[model samples]
Target: MLMAGCAHFAGRHPLLGYTEKDHPQADTALVVCAEQEQYICGITGVNQVATWEKFNGGKTPWVRVLPGKQVIKLTLSNSHQLNRQQVTIDDVQAGHVYRIDVGFNATLLTASYTDLGKMDAYTIHMPRFPLSPKAITASF
Candidate 1:
């Protein structure tokens, strides 16, 4: 899994991706992964409503997010179509993997979320139609 962080540390690389050896004491950890070949995508974060990490080529990006209502969307690199998913992050404990995958059904896009640490699973169907300009703008 590929990862990125906000603040930089001295002599530390701006980018880092690796498994956490120790227990990470936090509210929640979100791992957004997409397997669309030849397509680049990204997941939106809460602050400033911007895309956090770009899923380029063959890497999965992860970040730590607060436990609350979070709107996650995958923006295609070369298309206007956005596969969106709304997740209510509640009862998520640290040291667990909450994985979300963006996939397609025929031509329509979809999302499947699973907590590997538990028995929870969820599937969401993205919007059939492209979002209107006003509908998209109000979100930011």
Candidate 2:
């Protein structure tokens, strides 16, 4: 899956250097993608903003991150509406690649990933993906 995302990114950014070969020394790296769907994703940590993908119909590139056990919040928005889901993976380890697969359909929100082939198919208990955070935050 690592190579798959890398191949798709042809002329995007040089920072898309995400592979199973070389990794960060101390901190873990994060790569999030919306699969089988499209959504505008906003990633936030504590009070810091990480990244966001708007009208993302495909998977996103890898996002480098610090090593720590923290709760990273994500708000996904789409054309229809918006939704929010906070996901916490295991310990963020160094030299490891953390991939997040997000998707949504008519009924269920699908979020899952593998930790360097260490973890199995872990399902994220969320309402749905393809979620647009715009409408939701606007409600506030």
Candidate 3:
């Protein structure tokens, strides 16, 4: 997994596999903190049986953050096809480890929560192209 992260961080970020949404080539550059964790949640309904259950099973997935430095360079791959983009990582911390998640317009997904002062998902957006998992390149 670390090797894969290094490859993605050092080598070319892949764009060959993914569900293309709007275009054949769409991507964004992202800078994120890397951390490892396992999350599990269980909920019981009125019947007292475990109705809702989910677990991360002690897995690590890259999560995004606001760049604390001035500008962090990232290589983004197009979502539909093979491509790359150069972006600035704004308001994100440097050398800090965080669970990073790379995806398109993540802010929109949790806008209501953010506005309501709840736990909100951090996100970054690019004008021409947004960040997608297919374009994420990182070193864990």
- Highest-TM-score candidate: 2
Any runs in candidate 3 off by more than 4 Å, and if so which? Answer: 1-68, 78-80, 98-140
The stretch of ten residues in a row with the least summed lDDT in candidate 1 is 131-140
Candidate 2 lands at a TM-score of 0.45
Candidate 2: deviation at residue 73, Å? 1.7
In terms of lDDT, which candidate is strongest? 2
Identify the superior model by TM-score, candidate 1 or candidate 3.
Answer: 1
**What value does the lDDT take at residue 104 in candidate 1?**
59
**Residues 1-140, model 2: lDDT tens digits:** 55435433321421222233364333444434333346555453322543443323322233545556645566656667666666676576555555556677786455555566323222222222344322110000
Per-prediction CA RMSD (Å): 13.6, 12.4, 18.7
Q: What TM value does model 3 have?
A: 0.21
TM-score each candidate: 0.44, 0.45, 0.21
Q: How many backbone clashes does candidate 3 have?
A: 20
lDDT of 3 by residue, 1-140 (tens): 65444433331221111223342221222223222122111111111121111222111122222224322222222233222222233433323333232233432211000011112232322111133434334331
